[model samples]
Target: MEVEGLSVVYKRARDRAGAPDAAAVRDVSFSLPAGQTLALVGESGSGKSSVAMAILSYLPAGARREARVLRLGPHDLLAAGEGDLRRLRGRRIAAVYQNPGMALNPSLSIGRQVAEILEVHLSLPRAEALRETERLLGEVQIREPRAVMDLFAHQISGGMQQRVSIAMAMALEPALIVLDEPTTALDVTVQRQTMDLLADLQRRRGTSYLLITHDIHLASVHAHEIAVMRAGEIVETGTYAQLRDDARHPYTRQLLGSVLAKDPRPEARPGAPAILKVEGLEHGFSKAKRGRPAVEDVSLVIKAGETLGLVGESGSGKTTIGKLICGIHDRQAGAIELNGRALPTQFDRRGPSDRGAIRMVFQSPDATLNPAHTIGAILRRALAIAGAGDPKAEAAALMERVRLPAALESRRPAELSGGQKQRVAIARAFASSPRLVVLDEPTSALDASVQKEILALLVELQKERTVGYLLITHDLDVVAEMAHHVAVLKAGRIVETGATRRILSAPEHGYTRELLASRLVPPAATAPARPGAARDAPWSAVSQLA
Candidate 1:
């Protein structure tokens, strides 16, 4: 596969016609030999994904693409017509997206989704397609492929859903596969397993891969060649060792440096007052098979100015426990207390004070923030609901506290970057002066540099306000950086609980050990410790480039 001088531009909307058109990809060029991987590494909005979309002819409407030469195998991609591109898409080239849940159809059975590709591409009979589908599923390491055929996507675990996605991508044996952050949302163990499956399949089939992601560490371990993209252009390209040791471009060095920067773990404040407490918490979803409990016998405590990391795999009841405590889900059996006062089981049942004292931030800020509302309006509404004396001034103050510019107050959520949107979400969470905040996978979608900045902001806010945090995440690295105490949860039970350093360094539970083993550390972490190169660099250095 080869590309040279590829550029993509999207037309501005009529209302914004006065502004210049957006250049998503600018003069990007790269080559990937058969059976090798080339990684496009950058933060969100850096044009890595635009290059992929342009190659696959999958750009959205109003987008214009131009290229000097774009060829894959014997096909001239640039010359292919719409009909030709359609036939070539699933057969010669395939794509696996970041989120499998969004990529897979919820209403369709997993078998049908996988088999349809075989039938369309290979023109196989119904029975033969189904048989091939089962084989493909098994090849991707899914247990009981036959039984899984009848199950809908929602019925399977996230890892299994991703496996099904892989099966679909592999059904036609495409020569080139574009993996866009394929394992970003997965657990550490699941991520390792998924990558291993991809490697094994590549070894067997000699398929080339174009990996697009924000994780320099992941790209370092996976890609044969790495290209650093920033602000719609490729700034540098080389092997991981070359880029890591002697990068010439400042942006490239910043990306590498961000991954290597380590933060000191917050010390446990033994004398801090307990901000929130849960006892004998239990909750079960009605849709669950056999009425199984989603979370059972869960009990934890968070102290003022401290964070408690809840680590686990998908469906391990981490989010369930968080929701139960926040009154998002009514607990069947449990007791929640704030400052030694029992709280209501449901959010609506609680008084305004209780609601104001506890707040939660979801994983996807896009889903939580109303697209129709401006950032200032959202902040002001929260302040008014909390009975602030001056909602307008307090809203601006909240924006300032979150490190956002006051000018962005008028912009809607759609106008903000992922990092900016998350900052808004954090600001909204603090509007009510909450004593405890439940942060669910807050940094999973962000790039390494932005993630560090956001974490630093959270720490600063905690110090100023003495707020407690219940951080739920699968990223152990994040846990190490943020949490004072760590609790390992599996099947709704706490298998181990202790200091973050002790649990991460020396775990008592086998499950905890497995999670630790699956974590991917940067090469710098294992090498001789060097001074942090980007620690002193302003956050805007990365943010503006992104």
Candidate 2:
């Protein structure tokens, strides 16, 4: 596959007359050789997805694309009609999206979904397709393929859903697969397993890959070549070693610098009073599901101005513990104390002061922010709920404190950038001047640079307000940089707990070791080598060894 001088522009109806139309992708060019990977690394809005859409001829309506040369195998993507592109898409070219839960049909059984792909693409009969679907699921390392076939997507784990999506994509053995932030939503261990599966599949099938992501470290580990993009253009392109050792572009250097930089903020003052504490926490979604409590005897503490990171894989109860602390979920058995006072188990039972003092920020601001209301309105409402003296003035001050411009106050969340929206969320969380905040995977969806900025802001705010933080995330790098202490969770149990540096540098638990090993280390810190060679093994073999 090859592309040259590719440019894409979104024709917005709001554009002023005679104004210059900015292109989302400006003169982007790259080539992917068979059986190799080319990673497009950039921040959000950097046009990596635009390039993918252009290649697949899947751009949205009102979007215009042009290229001097665009060729995929023998077909000219530029010249291909909708019918031609449709046929080529699932047969020779395929795509795996960021969130498999959204990609897979929640209403359909996993078996039927994968079987339908086989039936449509390969013209197999229902029986043959169903049989093939099971084989494909097994190939992707999903256990009890037959059992999974009967279950819907919602019944399965996120990692399984992703594997099902990949199984569909791999059904026809496509020549080029576009992985658009494929593993971003997964936990570290699951992410490593997923990537390893992809690598092994590529090795066996000799399929080329176009990996689009904001993580330069991930690109360095997985791709044969790396392209750094910023503001819709490729600023630098080279092997990881070349770019890491000598990055000519300042943006490229900035991106590298932002990858898990050591937290420079002063440590929390020694002997600071404990702001939040949990003891003997236990919660279960269903008593019928024996031996698997959602949260089992979880316990941790956070002092004023300090962060306690809870690290684990999906379904390890990190978020469950956060919800329990925030009073969003009622714990079956536990004691939660804020400033030495026992808190209610349910959010509705909590007093106004209790509610105001313990706030939570979610992973996606898009889900939390109201589209119909302005940023000022959102902040003001939060302030009003907290019974602030003056909502209007406090709203503006909150925006300013979060480093957002006052002009954005009148704009709705849809009008703000992702980072800006997150800042607004943070500001709202602080509206009550809470003593503690439960941050649940707050920066997982953001780009590396934006993530660093957000973390820095959190540190600054913690220092200023002396607020304690319960940081729940799957990224160990984040734990290394943000947390003063760490707790490792597996199967809904705390397996290890210690200082951040000690847990990351020398973990005692096998699960913690696996999580650390899976994280993508910056190229400068590790020996120059590709990850594919080491990871090129069938998932069955790897899982058995585990």
Candidate 3:
């Protein structure tokens, strides 16, 4: 596959100055033979993903208005008609994404989703499709393939859903596939496994890949070669050893530098009072089929004016516990107390005033916001609910707090970007002026550069307000930088817990240690912190790793 003289650009309206919109891609050039992998790496708008999508012949119709030349697998993608290209996808090539929600049909069962692909692409009969789907699931190491297939997309866990997507992608055994941040949203072990699976498949089937991602270190783990893109062009391309050993481009060095930067837990005084606490917490959902609980017998704590990071694989009850505390989900059996008060195990029983102390920020800001309402109204409602002072004034203040312009108030949710929506969500969460905030992977939806800005904003908020944070995430690297306390949960149990310093530096539990190692940044950069006036940086505990 090769792309030559590619020149994709976009034209947008200009101000009185009348300057043309910048080119989204420019004179991009690259080629890959069969049985090898190449990566396109850059920031959100850098056109890395666009090049891959263009190569895969899957650029959305609207984007074709700008693409100049794109060729792949015996077809000139820049000129392929809709019908011709539609027939090519999933037969000779396929693509997987960071989010399963984007690719998997929400209402369909896993069995039907996987089976239909094989049926459509490979001309398999119904019985044969079912058998092939099962085998495919097994090939990806999905436990309980039979029962898992019967489950709905939402019924299965995120990791399993990812595996299902992979199984479907591999069903046709295509000559090549494009993976766009396939494991970005998963935990360390799951990421390691996914990479292992991809490696094994490439060896077994000789399937070439054009992997698009922002992760620099892991690029070394999988690809035979890497092509770093910047400003819509390939600035650097070399083998893992060649690039890491001789990283020349300033941008390439920055990307590598990021991997080794120490993200010590969010700064907080070690002696500060506890902001949130839980004792013998228990929560469970009714099983559709039988005895297992969705979340069972979990316990944890969060210090006042500090961040408590919750670490767990998907469906390991990390988010559920966060939800239970914030009154988003009912707890079947448990005790929940905020700031030492006796609260219900469930939200319904919790008093109106009590609920005001804790707030939740969901992952998908787009789905959570009301499309019809303006940004101001959404935040205003949150302030009103929590009885914050001068709701309108607070809403405007919140917009500023999240680093968003108050002028965006009149625009509806549709007019906003993903990062903007999340900024609004954070503003809403803080609108109540809650003592504690439940951040449910707030930055996961953003790209690397945007992610840093959000994290910096979050730390600023914590420092200013002295609010506690219950940070629930699958990404441990985030925890290393953001949490003052660490709780590693696996299979509905607290596998490890302690001071952020001790836990991360000298984890006693095997799981905790593995999590730390996965998130471990190589030793190179010094701690970048504001050095709060509150106290010394007691929570900056990289020594735990040392």
lDDT, candidates in the order shown? 0.87, 0.88, 0.75
What lDDT tens digits, residue by residue, belong to model 1 across residues 22-121? 9988887777778777889999998999999999999999999999889999999999999999899889999999999999999889999988888888
Question: Whole-model lDDT, candidate 3?
Answer: 0.75
Per-candidate TM equals: 0.93, 0.92, 0.81
Which 10 consecutive positions of candidate 3 have the poorest summed lDDT? 537-546
> Which residue window of length 10 is worst by lDDT in model 2?
537-546
Candidate 1 regions off by >4 Å? Answer: 260-266, 524-546
Off by over 4 Å in 2: 14-22, 262-267, 286-291, 524-526, 532-546
Tens digits of per-residue lDDT for model 2 on 327-406?
A: 88889998999999999898999899999999999999999999999999999999999999999999999999999999
lDDT order of candidates, best first? 2, 1, 3
Predict model 2's lDDT versus the native.
Answer: 0.88
Ranking by TM-score: 1, 2, 3
Better of 1 and 3 by lDDT: 1
- Candidate 2: which pairs clash? none
